[model samples]
Target: MNILILGSGGREHCLAWKLSQSKKINNIFAIPGNAGIAQIAECTALPINKDNFPSILEFIKNNNIDFTIVGPEAPLVEGITDYLEGNGHAVFGPSKDAAKIEGSKVFTKKFAVRNNIPGAKAYFFKKNDYEKAKEFIEGLDAASYPWVIKADGLASGKGVLICNSRHELLEALKDFFIENLFGKSGEEIIIEEFIEGFELSIMCICDGKRIIPMEPAQDYKRIFDNDKGKNTGGMGSFSPLPFVDNVLQKKILERIIFPTFESLKKEGIIYKGILYGGIIIKDNEPYLLEYNCRFGDPETQVVLPRLDNDLLELLVNAGTGNLGSTELAWSAKKCVCVVIASKGYPETFSKGDIIYGIKDYSNKSDTLVFHAGTSMDKGNIVTNGGRVLNIVSQDKTFNGAIEKNYNKIKNINFDGMQYRNDIARKVAEK
Candidate 1:
């Protein structure tokens, strides 16, 4: 079958890589794919947006693509699935209505409240509610030091900010309202009481009726090690969390995942794609941090490697509402993905620096390199975006995987390269 994957990031590259391995697949394609994806799939340079939907559809039709997998939230939030499906194309993603679970933080927060889904206590504010928001923040107790301020709309995973003090919160509000840093995306905002806990990314395939949960993955969002500094898309990720035993897994599935699917159903929304829950576990209780309509980056890099099932079949089944009879299989081995970014990522940095060492490890059985922000410059791969590449390694133990990635990463380098040193250090130490 001919398949088309949308977006240009590590997640899309990982999807292309996984789908390319399926013997049933006749051809694989990516829209605005990066260097790594181009190696294995036909990379179509088309902008993935609402205005470009027609062009994308034309390409799909021209290529006789059987299935299209969405790899990012932007196009999904913009209603690409609805458009494609309207034109008689098969797509593996939620409709625009269901994508509100990620598109609008305010919408998700209210939906959670209506569904009794556990989450952070939040205060919603409009762009015009600047003074009102400030007044509310000023009256808050000093004890609640770290508040999470988020833009209602998508901001490429950079919309959420952790303000540790009243002063910082006000500044963040200014950035949203006054400075218009996020523009229309920040027209509405959510300020929530910070939930203290470790974050887990749970990605489940929902076929409008049944939900098939993948192995849990833990990702480091902060650009610096020790969970410090600004948040990038994701710095690194590891699968099969050591902390998530059977009890915790059951709790997550029962309390968070099930209710989420039911809530979407209650809204008359038949979600048919990946329902990614950004969950925070506090005292062994799962709180819904957020919901991503599609798969999680870096998390996908690790999770897909641990998947023993054919990715193409799973996605096709989910898209066609045939997942009720589907069961997932996972490898016993652990996987780790360490992201290599530009020196000054999550902000601004240079690009077009040649990358090396990929050829040496690309053929290895235990290692795989998935490109994110990369491009071909004069026949040499160079940096193109902030989160550039994902260095993935698999092993029987987390320690082995972590060590393998770090050791192999030494060979691949570009100017102004930066990555987290402690991806799964805590788990490995245990």
Candidate 2:
């Protein structure tokens, strides 16, 4: 079948790679795909947003595209799925209303409270209520020093900040309200009690009724190693969490996943596609951190490599609302993905620096390079965004996979290139 993918990032490239391997696929196309995706699929220069919906629809019809997979949350939140479905096109994503779970923090918080979903204690405030928010924070005990301040709307994963003192908290609030650092996304803010724990990523495929879980993955969000520095899209990720036993998994599915789906159902929203929970495991118990309406970025880079089933078929089933009792298969091997980003990422950084050593490992069986922010410049591939590329390796052991990634990364370089050195380090050591 002819398939079309939306967005221009590593996630889209990975999706194209997996689907291209499916024998059932006839032709693959991507809208605004990056350099690596262009090598395997037909890449077009169409933007994936509400303003280009008509043009996107025209392209789909002209190319007789049978299915479309959305890779980013922006278009989904802007109602692309609703529009495409309204036009009778099959799409693998949630409707705009369902996407509000990710688009609005206040909405998700209220939904969690109403459904008794376990999460951090949070207080919401509008931009005009800075004084009330300040008063609320000042009334809190000093023990809650490190509080999480979040923008209610999306800010490319940089909206959440951890304030360790009253001075820091007030500055963050000023950045949100007075400085307008996050634009309209910061119009509403959430001051949440910071839960101390390691974060986990759980993605489930839903068909408006039933849900099927994928293997759990752990991703590093901070820009530097050891989880320090400000957050970026993602720094690295690994799959098949060594610490998550069946019991903990069951609790997450029961307490967080089930209630989330059922609650959405009660609200008359039929969610079809990926329901990704950003969960925090504290004291062996799971707490909901946030939700991403689609697959996680670097998490997808690692998770998809371990999946043994035909991804195209699964997505088709989910999109068509016929995902009946489907159980996923997975490879026993471990997978690791490390992101190669431009220096000073998650902030202002230069672009168009020439990259090297990618083609040397292009044909390696154990390693795969998925491009995120790259473009063809006079026959040379150059950096085009902050998070540029993903180097993924799969092996029978975590140590083997982790070693393979680092070894290959040494040969790849560009001006102002930066990456975390400790991806999956603890697991490999163990």
Report the number of clashing residue pairs per model. Answer: 0, 0
Runs of candidate 2 exceeding 4 Å displacement:
360-364
The lDDT for every candidate, in the order shown, is: 0.90, 0.92
lDDT of 1 by residue, 1-430 (tens): 9999998999988898888888799999889899888888899798998999999999999999999999889899999999999999999999999898899989999989888888999889998889999999999888978999999999888899989999999999999999999999999999998988888989999888889899999999888989898877889999889889999899888988898898789889899899999999999898999999999998999999888889999899889888768788889988999999986788896788898877434534798889999999998999999999899999998899999999988988888899999988888845
TM-score of each: 0.97, 0.97
Model 2, residue 423: what's the lDDT?
95
* Candidate 2 least-lDDT 10 residues: 357-366
Candidate 1 least-lDDT 10 residues: 356-365
**Model 1 whole-model lDDT (C-alpha atoms):** 0.90
In model 2, state the lDDT of residue 369.
94
Backbone clashes in model 2: 0
What digit string (tens of lDDT, one per residue) describes model 2 on residues 1-430?
A: 9999998999999999999888799999999998899888899998787999999999999999999999999999999999999999999999999999999999999899889999999899999998998898788788778999999998988899999988899899999999999999999999999998988999999989888889999998889899898878899999989889999999999999988999899999898889999999899999999999998999998999889889999999999998888889999999999999997787876689999988444533888899999988998898999999999999999999999999989999899999999999889846
Give candidate 1 misplaced runs (Cα > 4 Å): 360-364
**What's the alpha carbon RMSD for model 1?**
1.4
